[model samples]
Structure formats: structure tokens, C-alpha cells
Target: MSGAATLLLDAGNTRLKWALQQGAVRLHQGVADYADLSAWQAGLAALPAPAKAVGCNVAGPARAAALAALLAPLPIVWLQAAAEQGGLRNHYREPARLGADRWAALLGARRHHTGDTVVVMAGTAMTVDALSREGDFLGGIIVPGFRLMRAALAQGTADLGLPEGDAVDFPRSTGEAIVNGALLALTGAILQMQQRLSQRTGRTATVLLSGGDADVLAPQLQAALAVPLIAVDNLVLDGLAQLGAGDMPEQDA
Candidate 1:
């Protein structure tokens, strides 16, 4: 672990994120389109030979095959969702049906917080998962992300187009209205989930935000919720590191 880095990859619906970690420090990291082979190769070429390469891919099998070809000779441990992993319990009726990204992110949240935590990943699709104080995965909500929302409006409606404006309480322009509405909807969902988690757990839940839109939505969520809102980058990679450290859950038969 000290001499060689552990390569961690999180292949999401829209993008592929990677990180190389040696001990507690991250040596290198990058993001690229999941469909772009050249971009993936370029990023992989920059890293040193890893002692172990582990990944969580929710982008389907075609992308997984491409990743395998790209990382030839370096065997990868492609993680899957289990009933439990890294001290967090998966409550899905069919545990394997849970998204690998969400499972990893839940573990990531547990690694950072010992109390009730709400994991929000705002990417191509926004996911809001609640982790109890005891590290129980209480399921979550998923909705179309801001970009998707805007795109849906632009593509579905004849008069509506993608907006290029900031979020506001009352937007005068169409762009502003669309953008603000999306942001508001996202933040509103986060706040509601936080409240529900708090009520269920009897403790104020810390909101851990990640994914592409984390930075964009953090401030707004903080202003609205007035609670602890932490922005953690590459949470899935963090969970991968945990697995590399032998924190993986037992495999189901």
C-alpha cells in the first residue's frame, strides 16, 4: 500500500472518474467521457503501475468491456453491490439490484461520518441516499439532473430551449426560470430527504454532496437547509480505496 498506488475507477452513466492513491494521499486523478476510448487511454497512460486496480461500473457491459481492454494486463476487481460492504448494510430487497455507484457512495459517506448521513450525488441523474447512524442504507430517491431537466424541456417542448442563466427566486427570463426551477427542485428534494432522515433517526443528518453538480448545488443547499453540507469529490473512489484496504464485504453465494 505504501510503495505502490491503488487505481480506483468509477464509471457512471455519463462520465468515467479515476484516481490513484498511495496510502492516504491521492497521487493522480482525472475524469473523461465514458464513451471516449482515447480520453480513457490518455488518462490511464499518465499513471504509474498500480498495485491493485478496482472499479465500480454502472454504465453497462459495453463500457465495462472497453475498460477491460484499456487496462490490459492489469487485472481489475470490478465491485458489485452486496447486502453489506465496508460496514454499510444494503437494504435493497435484491441487494445486487442496487447501483454500484450508490453502494460505494454510501460506504464513502460512512467512512467520513459516524452519524446519520445523507449522500447526494448530483450527476447525469441525481441520487439522494440516507445512511443511518449505524451505517444502514435506507434507500434513496433519483431524479433527472439539472442538465437533463433542461434538456428534457428543450427537446420535449417547441418553445422551450436550454437555459443559460443563474438560479433565482423569481426569474424574469425563460432561461433564468428554467435554470432556477431545476436548481430549486434539486435542492428541495435534498432538504426534504434530510428532514425525513432526521425524523427517522432522531439526529440531524449531515448532507454529503458529490458528483458533477455538487459544487454548483452545495451553496444553494446550504443556504436553504442551514445544516452541515460537505462537498466530497470522488466519493466512489474513496470507497474503492476502502475495498483496496480489505474492507470489502463477504460475497453472496
Candidate 2:
């Protein structure tokens, strides 16, 4: 676990982020699009041979296959959501039905923080999950992210075209309106989850925010929540890193 780097891949809906990490230090990392593998391929050429590999493929098996072809010979442990793993218990009605990416994020969150937490992965789809102090996956809700919301509006409505704008105090233009509305909605959902988790745990919940849109959502959340917020670049990979260590979860095909 310490000598050779562990290759970690997190296949999201929109992107594939890969990293080579040895113990606590990340040796090399890069991201690439599923449709475009040039960077990923180039990265493979530049990266040293890793000792181990772990991944979660929420983008489906095709992407996993593509990655597997690239990292030929080195076997990867593609972890699925299980009843329990890495000390966190899954309380999903059907444990395997839970998204692999979300489960990984929770495992990563457990590594970073030990408290009542609202785990938010704001990506193609935003997932707001509740993790209790005792490491229980209490359930979560999913909603369209800012870009998806704006795109849906642009597609569904004739007036509101998907225009670039900023989140402001009061939006004057259609673009600004969409941007501000998305931010408000994102923060609102997070705050509500924080409140719910706090109410259930009887302790203030720390928001573990991750994914593509975390930076955009964090400021608004902090200003509104005033509770602890730990922003992670890629919690799924962190989860993969944990798996690479020794506490491997039951594999799912």
C-alpha cells in the first residue's frame, strides 16, 4: 500500500477522473471526457505502473471497459454499494440499488469527517445524502444540478435560452435569473438536509460537499448555513483510495 501507487478511477456521468496515489500523497492525477480519451491515454503513458487499482463506474460498463482496455494486465476492483463497507452501514431500502458513486463519496466522507454529515455531490445530478454520527447511510434525495436545470429550462421553454450569467442578489436578466435561482435552490436543498440530519442526530451537521459544482455552491452554502462545510475535489476517488488500502468491500458485477 505504501511502496507502489494505487490507480483510482471515478467514472461520473460527464467525466472520468483518475489518480495515482501512494498512501496519503497523490502522485499524479488527470481527468478526461468519456467521449474523448486522449488525455486519459496520454496520462496512462506518462504515469508509472500502479501496484493496485480500484474504481466505480456509474457511467456504465462501456466506460469501465474502455478504462480496462487502457490499464491492461492490472486488475481493478470495481466496488459496488453494499450492506456495509469501510465502517459505514448502508440503510438503502435495497443496498445494491444505491449508486456506486454516492456510496464511494460516503466512504470518503467517513475518512475525512466523523460526525452527523450532509454529503452533497453536485454534479450532472446533485445528490444530498445524510450520514449519521454512527456511520449510517440514512438515505438521500437527488435533483438536477445548476447546468441541468438551466438546460431543461432552455429546452422546455421558448423564452429562456441557456445563457451565461452570474448568481446575483436580484437577477435582472433571464440568464441571471436562472443562475441565481439554481444557486438558491441548491443551497436550500442542502440547508434542509442539514436541518434534517441535525434534527435526527441531535448535533450540528457538517456538510461534506464534493463533485464538479461544489465551488459554485459552497459560498452560498457557507453564507447561509454557517455550519461546517468540508469541500472535497473527488470524494469518489478518496473512497477508491480507501478500498485500495485493505478494507475491500464485496465486489459487484
Candidate 3:
């Protein structure tokens, strides 16, 4: 699989991230909006012909269809409950109900870590998932995303408004207050999960941060958590790329 190539795409809620790889070596990567297929086409245009495509569409089937249309003559694989192979094992009662993004992130985390791990994806939505040391796909929790929390506060309350400030200590202004409040709440939730899960497992859980808010939230979360924290960007895409490479085309790109 060293020289064999594969094309991976992840059409998530916030963005569309794609990468072409030959085994562990990444050839190219690009990101676009959910509504932007022009960028998707441009990304695909860079890839060599005869590339095996594998994708997970967490934003639903609309973008997935557009992507499939673009990859018309090529064999495009959309990960489904029963269609794929070699990713995280789905132990959920209804595997299809599980978000594809979370599943892909755990696949990457499980491959990256050794023992019991907690994958915290802080993006359009905050998802905290646990995978056993032996690769059991334990469940996870989902909460309102950071920006969504602020937006909700602004929309729900008349007095609580969005402020126009950066994330500062104990925000004095409305914007700072909203942003800080949201960040604090998100970190607090991570800390709480760490405490609760660590007590039962005894082993210090490894916290992996992914998604958009990870850069901002990791520092605050690190301060609150008793365990260690690691930030991995585009983990879901990497995972998809890994899985796609299992059966990648034999020719060099």
C-alpha cells in the first residue's frame, strides 16, 4: 500500500476537507464550504486518475450527492453502516444513527493511541467519545457547539448580547463575556467528563482535541483536566484517508 493512492473527502457541517494520499504520505489537501462545489472540483482536479475515493458526509446527503456527481466516472465510496471496512467498530445500537464524523475521529484516535482514550471533538458541535484500549467503540456525549452556545444566549435572552471583544479573562464586555462564558462551559464539561470517567477506569484518560475550537479550548481544558491533552487537526479526514488506503489503487499517483 506504500505507492498505491487513495482520495479521501469529509463533508462535515462547517467545511469540506479532502486529501489525496499514498499510504502515509499525503499528496494534497484542500478544504471548502458545504455549498462550494467549485472548490471541491478544483481539489479533485489535482488528483491523478484511477484514484479510489472514500468519503463520509456528516452534513447529510445533499453534499454527498454533489460530490458523487463530481466523481462521476471514478469509483466513489460513501461510508455507510454496512458498506465499509477497517475503521472504528460501531457498538452503538443503531450504527447508522451515529454521526459519521465522530466515528471517523475515533477511528483516527484509536489508531493513534494505545490504551483507553477519550476523543473530544470541539467543532460545529462538541463531541466527547471514549474508545477502550482494546478498541471497543464506547459511546460519547454531544453538546451545543461553542459558537452555538453564544448564539443561543444572544437569541434566547434580550439582555445577554454578543460582545465585540476577544477571549479575555473574566470578560467585562458583553462580547468577551459571551465568548469566555462559552469557552468556560465547554472546558468545564471536559473536566467533568475526565473526573467521572477517570474514577472508574483508574488509568489517566488521554484527551485528544480535534475540530475548530480545539486551539482556543485546549489550553483552558488542559488547565482544568488532571490528564494530558493532545490536539490533532483534521483527524477525521486523516482517518478516512487511512481507511481509504486499505484498498487504494495499486498504481502510483
Candidate order by TM-score, decreasing, is 2, 1, 3
Clashes of each: 0, 0, 1
Error of 2 at 7 (Å): 0.6
lDDT of 3 by residue, 13-62 (tens): 87888888888788887787767687768656766754677877887767
Candidate 1 residue lDDT tens string, 78-137: 888899777778898899988888888888777778899989999999999989999799
Off by over 4 Å in 3: 81-89, 247-253
- TM for every model, in the order presented, reads 0.93, 0.95, 0.88
lDDT of 2 by residue, 1-253 (tens): 3578888889889888989999888888878888778667776776778877888888988888887877777777888889998999999999999998999999999888998999999999999999998999999999999789888999999888988888789899888888999999988999999999898888999999998999999889878887777998889888888888877854533
Off by over 4 Å in 2: 250-253
lDDT of 1 at 241: 80
* The best candidate in terms of TM-score: 2
TM-score of 2: 0.95
Candidate 2 colliding pairs: none
Worst 10 residues of 2 by lDDT: 244-253
Q: After superposition, how far is residue 237 of candidate 1 from its true place, in Å?
A: 0.9
Model 2: lDDT of residue 85: 85
Candidate 1: C-alpha RMSD after superposition = 2.2
Q: How high is the CA lDDT of each candidate model?
A: 0.85, 0.88, 0.75
